[model samples]
Target: MLEHLKKEQINPSIIEEIKKYRQKYADTADTSQTSLRYLYYGKEIWEAAVHALLCGENLLLAGSKATGKNVLAENLARAFRRPCYNLSFHINMDASSMIGNDTFRNGEVVFRPGPIYQSAVDGGFCILDEINMARNEALAVLHSVLDFRRTIHIPGYDQIPVHPATRFIATMNYGYAGTRELNEALASRFVILQMPSITQDNLTRLLLREFPGIKKQFAEQFSGLFSDIEKKCESGELTEKVLDLRGLLDALRLIQNGLSPYPALDMGLTNKTFDAYEQTLIRDIITTRISKKTESTTIFS
Candidate 1:
């Protein structure tokens, strides 16, 4: 991962800091997940995130759907070789659920650590996914943990200081359903990064990386198809649900398995929304880039 960072042109000093951090926390930092499934394609984003983590600042990644926010978070954790704990925020999430709660042990009550608590003590990376989905009041618990205080205060027990290698990466999708504006007090706790939409070049790089055998021409078409869907979403012609990178990858996989491009795309992208009208629009977009008779063998090496 450090070598990959070097190839991406990340700051050499930042890479060195990451290397030192890994060695410093070798005993506590979990290295079980050695590598990431997807490498985040943007060098600027990688540099910014690595610098932020090295500075010991919590990060809030604010962006639209399919912008690779979560992907970048996982990539950062893997780059630093830290054990990652993913905590998805929802309406029902609360401080107790995040930090930990008193529970019954073999004979008596005990405090069972949650993801945040475990990450704090073990020098792990805690990914707060879709952070805005929870109420502002529910998220207030993170203020001290994220800020310079760097401590988790359990009401009845002693405060646990966060390990130096522990980092929090939170993601929020703009205007997503059931999400509210994060309060200024809570938002002020971390440095925010406004994530940009995936560019055509990065999209192509992602496709080629994910499917090495896929033809470059087919990869370009798929990238074009995604861009078209994103444009429709921007124009309010379709919801963001159809602007699916994972769906496109799944479609490519199906094509690899001998499914025709159209049907594969229909199942992967068009079928994501049940609205007949929206499905028709998505199908039209797919047809513009992927031909009906395009064969699987032609798409792959």
Candidate 2:
């Protein structure tokens, strides 16, 4: 990962600091998962996030769908060589679920540690996924943990001080259903970075990275197809449901496995929306770049 950072031309000083941090917390490193599936492409975003984490400030990644917020979060954790604990926040998420809850075992009450608590104790990276989905009041428990105090206070248990290497990375997608604006107090606790939508160049790079045997022309066409769908979503002609990067990738994989392009795309992209009219629009967009008779063999070398 450090070598990849050098390839991206991240600041040398920042890279050095990251090395020092890893060395200092070498014992906290978890080697179970060594690499990220996808590498975030934007250099500026990478630099900003790396710098913020190096300064011991938590990060809040805010962006629209398919902007690589979670990808970057995982990449950051991998870059720092820390164990990552993911906590998906919803309406039912509360302090007890986050910090831990009391459970009876062997006729005795035992405190079961949650992701946040485990991450704090182990100096792991805790990913707060879709943080805005949870009510603000439920998040109040994080105030001291995120701020200068760096501690978690449980009423019946001893105070737990956050490990020096522990860092929280929260991701929120604006305008998502059931998601509300994050409260000011929680928002002010971390340095926020606005994630940008994946660019055509980066999309192409991602395809080539994931499928090295894929032909260059097909890669460009696939990425262009996604770009068209994104533009349509922005114009309100189609909902964001069709703008599925994962679906597109799955379609390509299906194509590689012998499915025809159109049917593969139908399973991957067009069928993501149940609306017939929207599916037609998506099919038209797909036809503009991909041939209906394009065979699976033609996609790869």
Per-residue lDDT over 217-257 for candidate 1, one digit per residue giving the tens place of the 0 to 100 score: 88898899889988999999999888878788888899989
Against the reference, the lDDT scores of all candidates come to 0.88, 0.92
Clashing residue pairs in candidate 1 (N, C-alpha, C atoms within 3 angstroms): none
What would the per-residue lDDT of candidate 2 be over residues 70-148, giving only the tens digit for each residue? 9899999999999999999999899999999999999999999999999999999999999999988899999999999
Model 1 alpha-carbon drift over 4 Å, by segment: 235-239, 273-281
Alpha-carbon RMSD of each model: 2.1, 1.8
Minimal lDDT window, size 10, model 1: 29-38
What are the TM-scores, per candidate, against the unseen true structure? 0.91, 0.93
Cα error, residue 176 of model 2, in Å, equals 3.0
